[model samples]
Target: MGYINIDFTAGCTNNKWENLLHTHSIIQLVNTPTRITSTSSTIIDHVYTNHPENIVETVVPKIAFSDRYAKCITRKINQKDMPCLCHKQIRYRCFKNFDENNFLGDLNKTSFTQIEQIIDVQSATAMWYQLFLSVINNHAPIKMKRIKHVRQPDWLTDEVKEAQKKEKCLPKQRELE
Candidate 1:
């Protein structure tokens, strides 16, 4: 496997991670490793600014695996009018806050004070639900069963070949004319 080292020190001051920009005909893989590491400077900025390391670790992984998770999230949120943040780093920030609030699971009774100190329950519930929707958007399950075999290759197995002899034997439509 090849790894690319992203050095923040090499970035221009006032950098907005513009050097990592990619022109994509399909935005499905926006969070892939190449795309994510392009923002190494921003991640380093957060680490130096005293943000929690857990947040950084969690977010960076998501950004790096853009082909897997990024594509999933883009489709889940639909190709409609949802804000861009709902599919990008902004989603990570939202998840961090939601996790801190224990949105996926409840905290132990002893940690009630800790929960109160970090986040309020009122926003916690709504934020938690929003994050849940984000996950659903990004990780939509592939429904392979729903997909019919629309085309078959000539080189496929015997059963497939038996199914469509005409595909190979039929006259070429362009030549026929």
Candidate 2:
């Protein structure tokens, strides 16, 4: 992709830059004017791609920073080529049957004398860690499960979804008020 700041609509004059891009088999995708003002509109920002066939759609979103709009391109993707499309295996501890009183009783019954007897600080820490880990594992065992991964657009986050829900409810809220 190539973006150059040149007026592409200058009275139908032969554009050397465009001609150069054509020579290299590159095609300009954006036809709409990128920069617009009250007096005039011009295609100052350009988007060029060599593999135009792979591009599914080209959009010039109406989000203005200055006078220029943001350019977006959607490309065709193969599902088999994406590893993220497959179900992923993950291990997690299940705490559904965990009892706080039972866990506490087991912890209290556990002997820490072996750990205390160890003169080395590292070995004592390791033994202490292992003792706690064993008790925790017995109470809440680790299980593996496969989960399907779903992909969402980068701009559509949890916060954005919440905001959208609130926006949808505004009309009803106003009517009640």
Clashing pairs in 1: 31-66, 32-66, 33-64, 72-138, 73-138, 76-137
* Per-model TM values vs. the true structure: 0.14, 0.46
**lDDT for each residue of candidate 1 in 8-121, tens digit (9 for 90 to 100):** 343323323343222222111112333334334222222111222212222334543342222222112334564443322211122323344443343232233333453656
lDDT of 1: 0.33
- Counted clashes in each candidate structure: 6, 0
- The per-residue C-alpha lDDT of model 1 at residue 97 equals 32
Q: Identify the candidate with maximal TM-score.
A: 2
Tens-digit lDDT string for candidate 2 (1-177): 344677677574446876898799988788778888999887777777798888999888888878888888998877877677568886667999999999999999999888868887855665686688789999999898787965556988999879767745655654554
Residue pairs that clash (backbone atoms under 3 angstroms), model 2: none
